[model samples]
Target: MAKNKNGSGFSRRKFLKGVGVGTGALSAGLLSPAETLSHAGGALAFGTPQGPGAVPITLHINGQAHRLSVEPRVTLLDALRMDLEITGAKRVCDRGTCGACSMLLDGKVIYGCSMLAIDAQGHEITTVEGLSHNGRPHPLMTAFVAHDGQQCGFCTPGFIVASKAFLDRTPHPTREQVNHGLGGNLCRCGTYHGIREAVLDVGNPTGKAKTGGQAHGAL
Candidate 1:
């Protein structure tokens, strides 16, 4: 509250009006939160309420940097699949309950749908598509195919990414450990048995990879 020429402070009604104006500006995209406010007549100054529209953001994913334009509300999953065309992270149960949208942020498992694209700026993002080597499939991916870990494919990508992160932490996991490690993801197809087996086989240095050729389809 500022004193006017008469040395009077702002009334409650005037303070509320200023707050409303600031809030409206944010939602309507007229001014970003980072934008500085200007003073006019010792009162809250509001710009023309035009939507902020899409803003440019850069994301580092899969050993590459991508520049794109998106609204602040866009989730990392939407930005990956819809904007950048990097669809390895599947979107299911977008509320972060199901791990279907799992991806790696700095080698740690995360739900892409639960994080904003604007907030994923600095992390090293790795989707399922990024798991493979130069020309060969990632060992975990190969293990999934060998064990028939995926069916219907909606949850495969998440499982693969999560499994990768889990194994990175627990390289030699028991069957029970593998089960607990993948507790966050779900497979409606009830392929938990094969999924756990895949993780176990990948963790086992002496276990032979199965002669399975079924491909993990696109996310």
Candidate 2:
């Protein structure tokens, strides 16, 4: 009975060893020839060759095509400022909360920092630098200057870009609408009143002109 017990134990150990070998061989065999080659190539490639960097992208900015090579992780703001030298979009906060990096994507307002350069491809992107035409400033830009809407001027570009978008959609927005629309931008110099007046001036330039003319006539 002891001999039988010893024999059973030996058989069990042998069976376990066999199972282990069989599993390893089965796993190796399960991988197809193409898969094995690919795995080997991947390892060797990583060891010997450097991976490709910075994919090529074509961006339609302000009615012009700009060809650029940029990394996948680069934001639209970085690509625009660093690569393309278009620095109108400020890099304040570097987060989507502040509208400092605001720009027009397909005629719609979007934060440049929040959007990936790859995603901006194949779309028309309008930056603050591009808002002007024929060396003339945009109406919103002109109004901002006329109304003294900016202070330190760091946040001016973003405000102007956002205002352009707002005016495009609602050309005749009320003072309350301008305030609400521009609430996303923060002014450190307490220039909210001027900004609001600038937006209002864009919508009601005739009124401003008439008032100015009457003031001059009275004087």
Candidate 3:
């Protein structure tokens, strides 16, 4: 029953206790939507129009259409590898730097890991596994094997996909052009010699060296 100097009934200890209760109530009112939903035993809706559960999406991959339920936040690479079971696109350096997750979207090379699956709708996605026809290897794939362009083989799929897209545009690229074109991709095995040889062989179809490309790996 301690009293203040002013002889008021409201003691400092009582004021402090009231302040703590008020702060707790204020904090409860300011809970995030997700926290509120969880406390109320409700689910949160994702994407626009706000509905529960994953969004339904359609993907056109390798001349085939597939329907899948995926979260809007899922990346195209994750959708391809986890949902579609297309494991050819490697998930290395997923920040779009290493190019190990490169794939063709609408016939243009794109970083699969950096693209959202929801954003890939209405476009043709081509992975390295799609380059073959009826179990027949692509010409670039054939050349890669012949020239021993891959070692450890993790980055080969992305390199092949990117190379195929480049070759499609520039049928006869110089070694410098090839080096610049494939600059985004990195091979830890130091297979630039073999990869340059493979592309040159495909472009020329005869053994003839044009330019010596600097041996450098993508970061």
Best by TM-score: 3
lDDT of 3 by residue, 1-219 (tens): 235888877766447646764222212223455543442422233344521335556678999876665677779998887666677998998899988999999999999999988778878999998999999999999999999999998899999999998888877777777888999999998998899889877876754444445422222
Q: Residue 170 of model 3: what lDDT?
A: 77
Model 1 residue 119 distance off true place after TM-score fit, in angstroms: 0.7
> Top model by lDDT, which number?
3
lDDT of 1 by residue, 1-219 (tens): 233556576555346646663232222123343332221112222354322576556678999877666677889998887666677788889999789999999999999999988778778999998988897899988888988998898999999999999988987676656767899999999999899878877876565322233322111
Off by over 4 Å in 2: 1-52, 208-219
lDDT string, candidate 2, 52-76, tens digits: 4554555778888766656667799
- Whole-model lDDT for model 1 versus the true structure? 0.75
Clashes of 2: 0
User: Where does candidate 2 clash, by residue pair?
Assistant: none
lDDT winner, 1 or 2: 1
Q: Kindly report which residue stretches of model 3 are placed more than 4 angstroms away from their true locations once superposed.
A: 1-53, 209-219
Could you tell me the lDDT of residue 97 within candidate 1? Answer: 76
